[model samples]
Target: MSLYRPHKKGTTPSGYRGTVVARERDFTAPTVQLLNPAGVLRPTPEAEPYLPLVEALPDTTLEQFYRDMAISRRIDIAGANLQRQGQLALWVPSHGQEAAQVGSARAARAQDHIFPSYREHIVGMIRGLDPVNILSLLRGATLGGWNPAENGNFHLYTLVLASQTLHATGYAMGIQFDGSVGTGDPETDAAVLVYYGDGSTSQGDANEALVFASSYQTPQVFFIQNNQWAISVPVSRQSRSPLSLRGSGFGMPGVRIDGNDVLVSYAVTRQSLEEARSGAGPSLIEAVTYRMGAHTTADDPTKYRTDAEVAYWAERDPITRYRTWLEGRGASPAFFDEVDAEAADVAADLRRRALSLTAPTREKIFAHVYSEPHPLMAEELAWLDAYESGFEGGAA
Candidate 1:
């Protein structure tokens, strides 16, 4: 039996489960969308100033955007398959989020820092991180595989849910302390971009981070990829209104955009990050997208969602829509074929690296518990060794 079916009218007080939350009124908050699901480009008044920016982007760069989305989907599939094959301890699929992540990541400058909430593989990919680096984490080979300071300022993936918002806010404040903002030097000034899900909007840490960000006027953009479902809890349960409205309450401007459309995602993010970098305080973005796959390798989304809903989103597939737009723009079949071949090569390489990863040794867990060793850590380590040595022929 399907675990999640829509409720009937008058079945509940709010007509949606038994809660008396905000009623679903007229959907007045306009969503910025440049490309429709039919693969046609339609101009929007809110997105006007940014359309020229998209046009000014070189054709090579535009083509690369599509390539990034295609390749990231390949990598996402590889990760999920590797988990099923027991190569990875866990997998967080980014199957349907490539456009939202890739578009925004590309919009940020190289000098800007980024904070990712575990599932942003494409964002990390754009910021000079090899997909293998993330595989090491999911495969239980390392706590963190790459150095954030040296690797294009992409911070380590924070899995604690919404905690990265505080970290991002603090980092943005540090940038301010270091005189990195309002210097009239775009190259030297730095901004921060942090990614989180719609579910996180309800978390205290995320709200607190926004409060701090607003108070300090931090140079940061809070990118919330509202993937509709937060691990089986629909976004409807999280907020009564659009998630972007939360920003206005915190004294920052907010924007809601169609996350599946790469054009809107890229254009909106560029504008928001520019405002932050110019010392105009923080901004919030709610990118309306969907997670086509399960929340994780362990999740069975079929239990909580209907196949019909999934099919509806599949019809609005970001990659498919973008590919259609590209074809209309005369992107040759040869280029598309080449991109497919490149994605296959990337997937193959990732599989090889994922299989080659070695599990971390038990002793390695004690390496970074603290800056200096403590008596408790020493006692635990010694006790662990003694217990393991009791086995026949075990290393002392």
Candidate 2:
């Protein structure tokens, strides 16, 4: 089970010896929540200002959020199955965190650059990535070979934790230096949206990124999907307080929100990204959600997690919770049925394609190690060929 505690009022900030005026999301209110676990539209008072943004969204955009979550859940299940069937080396599950990903990805504009952690398959899809491309990485066919510029600027995933934070901050700084931000032009102003996880917050890279982003006031958003557990380690074991508070400690706004509520995720991220692109500097968002599955296909959640905890989070499953809200908003049953059918088709297609994926030639490894041909690569290629030819029955 995950151990999470909301930051209480008047709790003096600790650890820092400097003049620390803690600027938490709220002194009393809990995380930002709009939809209850039961799919009821009970917005927290702190979320009132963002309701207008949600209300202004077109019907199609709103429904697309639910569709994305549903499809993501399906793709996650398929990926896990593929790993179990020995088609892939590993699979990262993103089941319970769909709302957080879908909402945040949709919030970013086309010109915005997105730096993602490895588990953000849904986010990549939202940014125009083919889901099959994600499977290719686990299958060892390529090293995240997708071109970001051609794929809605969705950068390749970084399996190394928290490194993307620095990459994103640097990119945001470049945007600032290039005069691409705060131009009052909605279409051209670009910001950076980077996703990391709870565990990454403990990394030096993440902290350094936050420091640089704040010092430069970079056009970036540091999105932390606090999924309660970083692998088997409960979040409580990682830090003494809420992760969002790190924003204030770094001179930026920190927000904790109900990550299971797609609406809250969308609204909060949308506003934060707009603030970033407008040159208001960077902010942090900690989405308090749950990881309803193992950390990866190589993990066994039954070893550390509890059934009751899983049940509790399952009750608030992002896809179903958002579906209930969509239904309440007069979304027709036909639309939901269509979404389910499409999800199945997508999963089936991925499975077929994944199975058909052939192993790349040995030479494939030497193809793109360098942007330009290097003497070292040529030497290594020659050695590899000679070594292979020396094997029994091998060609000269």
- Number of the predicted model whose lDDT against the real structure is largest: 2
Model 1: residue 219 alpha-carbon error in angstroms: 0.2
lDDT of 2: 0.91
Encode model 1's per-residue lDDT on 1-396: one tens digit a residue. 986777687575345555567866854567888888989888677777778778888889889999999999998889989999988889998888888998999999999999999999888889998889899998888888889987889999988889999999999999988989888898988899999999998999999999999999999999999999999999999998899899898999999998998988998899898888888889999999999998999999989999999999999999999999999999999999999999999999989977887777777878778888788888888899999899999779
| Candidates' C-alpha lDDT | 0.91, 0.91
TM-score for each model: 0.91, 0.91
TM-score of 2: 0.91
User: Candidate 1: misplaced stretches above 4 Å?
Assistant: 1-27, 386-390
The per-residue C-alpha lDDT of model 2 at residue 213 equals 98
lDDT of 2 by residue, 1-396 (tens): 645554445453442345556676433326998888898888999888888888899999998998898899999989999999999999999989999999999999999999999999999999999888889999999998599999999999899899999999999999999999999899999999999999999999999999999999999999999998889999877777888889999999999999999999999999999999998999999999999999998888899989999999999898888888888989999999999999999999999999998888888879888899899999998999999899997756
